[model samples]
Target: MFSTFARIRTLYSSTTFTNNTSIFRCIKTIAPSIDQCSNPFSGKGSCGRSVPNDDYFATIHHVSNIVRRDIYLERTLNKMHISRIVNSELVYRVLRSCCQHGIESFRFFNWARTQHPQYDPTTVEFEELLKTLARTAHWETMWKVVQQMKAQNIPISPSIVSFIIEHYGKRGLIDQAVELFNRLKNFGCSQTTEVYNAMLFALCEVKNFQGAYALIRRMIRKGTVPDKLTYSILVNGWCSAGKMREAQEFLEEMSRKGFNPPVRGRDLLIDGLLSAGYLESAKGLVRKMTKEGFVPDVGTFNSLAEAVCKTGEIDFCIDLFNDVCRLGLCPDTETYKIVITAAAKAGRIDEAFQILHRSIEAGHRPFPSLYAPILKAFFRRGQFDDAFSFFSDMKVKGHPPNRPLYTMLIKMCCRGGRFVEASNYLVEMTELNLLPMSRSFDTVTDGLKNCGKHDLAKRIEQLEISVKGI
Candidate 1:
């Protein structure tokens, strides 16, 4: 009997029941073992048998009752209208349950407000509802909720205001975000450093670096001293805008003020410099950061490696990668991938494969991205046999070909007048349910027809239709 209960407890703990209904179902399945009485309150066992007095059984019964109550409330809230004054606690519970179901909480909130003139939701409850609306991107509904809060003379918290500002900025509504930031006081919230940072981020997101700088000046004038984060934001903004000189100037100013820019800020400038073809400048910044006791992370090295590779400086990138390893920073999968790609692009296929072999021996799964450049290089050089051999090896190693890769191969075959191979690839794509883009398909079809393979062209078109149906 004890073993049976132990098994039941293990199952209960391991199972993840998603809803009240699943919980109720689980309870019903388990109840027969513990529910001894025909009447559960009769204090007897099943079939007139005696049962043990165990706390586990009592706890299970209590949990079952809670699940049952939640299920009942969900059904009742959907069907029953609130005619009398409902307690704020009950309203909060219903709102939470509605949120769980992804149902709009506004309807219940409206009903709760009308329940009684004095029945106001607590700030926490209101904030929870606002968060739900924001998460669902129901911006208009969120505004209505805010307006309702204002009508009730409830003070808007800084957290809520910041959330709205961030949301607006994310949606590219820069003007709306700025308007909200400016009206914090009108919303009965004070502008803190958090709000200031949020506004700066919004300004930076829109590439309004001049405005962000002006805002920083205004913050300083208003006695709101800019912190490290403030300087970082300005630096990042200038870097993103391709104004590396301005970014460097800001870093100097930050240092003069006795605050060094953060690692992330430096990384941003390094990325910007590398992207703008200032390789020497980016390397100098890295040396400066190291001199300042900031160890460059793997990401920083990877970014520089990838950027240098793009500029056809494969040897330089390899040396940099070796330096990273010598400094005791382990290269990640992305590091190997970038190096492999660069080697392949430089037509050093043997070196690329050597790196891939080393990475695989190091227990890294060969991702599709790592294979893409090599395959493309082979295809570009008209090495069809080698490309197909590698493609088969990729499948054997559990890195199955994806849609984009298949599309590229098919397009390459069609372009090279390998009509039979193109048709075979098209069939394989259809089997995998990967529909080629219409443009790619049209190109292949036209190529096949021009090559006098009318039947293959028709077959490809038929496969396209089948994929669309799927």
Candidate 2:
């Protein structure tokens, strides 16, 4: 029911585009009227300033929406009145956005080619379209695109083949993936390490570990030096299959063969266990590593802490943090963020404050994210005065709160029936040259009126009108 590039000649020959001045007039309206609402910085006010419209993003968004929704895509798109000729970047962006709908993307691509001024779809557009088709399992259409690429003299790169092979593996089309892997040379694409890794991942996806191991050996023999990802892939695969012993042995065997990974195999194991949802095993391994005084990499430790915290084990994560600190692993901001957020959410505001102080002592500047949780915790406990004091202190001492933090504070104030305070924050935002969300204005306006502060509400309305240029 859908048209491909093979039908482009017939489609283009029958269709005609008019330079109707009315059509061009409609183009302005199509350039996204919601730009003002979606981007608060796109209006004529003190707070909301205008910026030049981004034509590429606007065109891609418009074309993608049409392609995704319209069944008769070519017909609907032919009626589109773009003010300027479509470029290669615009074609690629539109194709990328319509990735899940291969046929419609193809139809749109063909339609783009038919546009006046001879729009030539470049290699980039073709490559992105091929990936879109492959990802959507439109194998027939994907092959058609490959043939088109060949005819256009655009050689397929190994990276493109690698992407397709990985997607094939994801979809469990193992045999097809293998066939493509074996035929890369025929496609004039070399067997790069990326291709090997992609093929290895496909084999591993199907639990063909024996085959994956054989391929690794073949990869080494072919003089393609394996990278960290090459080793990590097999380790993660083995861990996923519950073959922990085999995963460890394989890493050791590779190391003994002079193929030592850049990072430690044990770190990979913990990561693999974590990724495979073996949380308890990951925790046990961390404990064992800490006992032997082997300080886990900071990144690995942070990952473990974050994962454990998500399982509502905040206390356990805190203990783990203490253990790692003792091992001289200085926690990064992310480490503090994870713990602070968890502690605040768990109502341990005191503990959250302690972590925030530690972060500051370590010379890390407190951002809104680091401190917002504590504010929220104070509000949750009805410590409104404390939250206000904390906000004031942050403004005077640390990085000034950004637009989002002010928005959060304003909403929280309205929810607590502190309409006057919320209105004050709204005005403060304008003073700081930050554009507040339109809904923030509505909230404060309504709240003030409800509390019989109609005078204050009217002033806020006039301020909003000035800021929004309404």
Candidate 3:
């Protein structure tokens, strides 16, 4: 039996059957007796059926043909005509493979329907295709597929309905989503909480707070109790729309209904308050959250610190950082980055360096953007030696100097009339394949020529041309 399978596999490998007739003939030749294996078409197998020694060979043959058919469809989709008839089972496997390739699924779907009028896709196959369309945001194609299903009287499942609703809602097609939800029965689906929640989420995502509230009333009228997730969705929607008053009212209503509004709701409210410049209110909420046994995470604190820093309350930012440490919550790289940015902006170079060093000790590899602020501060203060040393350290730590840093150094050197140093940095920039701005190169080249270094200026010009060609 094993020898038979090996020979068949070799035959398939050796032959390239472009048309379905040849492939089908090959399949028929290798197929074992019906009594030898479980019936592939019966959808059931009787117990104690006699097993054939060549059943494995038949199974391998089916799998190999399926793979070959898939490859043929993928490569010859544009040119090959489906003239030869294939079984529904093979067509189903080909459809599934097409779904995995995204948009090509639609092409194959259209081709399959036209080519094999007798082979109607099952519910599972349609569902998989719809899921693929939704995931890829092929909205128009999805609607067309849905229409085809309707015309064929195919039963649409609740999961498929939910996927369409959720995607339509996310794409801001709220009316279409709602219409689909209302027509659930037409599609032979029973309305459930999952469907209702999907609709509610869609409304919330589009900031249709009034529509969401009305939908909640409708849910109650239908005797469908709104779940905790339903209320949280509304609260988040209101908060995101900057309607803190309404958001808080919804939170109170959630509590009255014997549901503790989740931490996400409170976080959204806090974020909204901070964004609206209600710093005092935002801080009060943080305190309230802690008292309610819900400690704010590092991200929440970092947001507050950033907002406080923007208001020039550097002291308060420092106090918040100290509080984060006292609570035994280890500061993340973002937390340190925010503090460093604030310190650098305030010209507190020593404090910025201290924080940066601490971040490095805590295993955070510094980004070049993080170094920008302090580097600019050092350059402004005329601390040339300190700036060069910092640049050396950055390179040693595996961050070679980037274009902006080189540009800064070149501009500073030009301003100070350090033509020799500027020319050396220009060469290094070229060596690192980092191109400075054309204006910076022109400025340095002209400065060197004016300083009587004609040879070096000519070389710099040549380097600029070579780098540009690359």
lDDT of 3 at 266: 71
Tens-place lDDT digits, model 3, residues 142-176: 87887888888898887778877888888898998
Model 2, span 238-284: residue lDDT tens: 99989999999999999899999878989999988988999999999
Off by over 4 Å in 3: 1-175, 182-198, 205-233, 240-265, 275-280, 287-295, 305-315, 415-419
Candidate order by TM-score, highest to lowest? 2, 3, 1
Which candidate leads in lDDT? Answer: 2
Q: Which candidate is the best by TM-score?
A: 2
Off by over 4 Å in 1: 1-149, 152-196, 199-231, 234-279, 287-295, 306-315, 333-337, 438-470
lDDT score, candidate 3 = 0.68
Local accuracy of candidate 1 as per-residue lDDT tens digits, 1-470:
12322332332123221222222232223323222322332323333224233422442344323333554533444333332223344455555555533234665566556644555577767887886676567878888888888888888888877777776767778999888888887888988877888788788888888898888768867877666567766666676566888987867776676555455567767766765567777888876765565656777788888777777889877666655565666678988988888888888888788888878887887888888888888888999889878987887774778988888888888777776676666666655556667777788778879988786677666655555543
Q: For each predicted model, how many residue pairs clash, with residues at least 3 apart or on different chains?
A: 0, 0, 0
How many pairs of residues in model 3 come into backbone collision?
0
TM-score of each: 0.51, 0.84, 0.55
> What is the Cα-based TM-score of model 2?
0.84
How displaced is residue 189 in candidate 3, in Å?
A: 10
Model 1, global lDDT: 0.67
Q: lDDT (0-100) at residue 194 of candidate 1?
A: 78
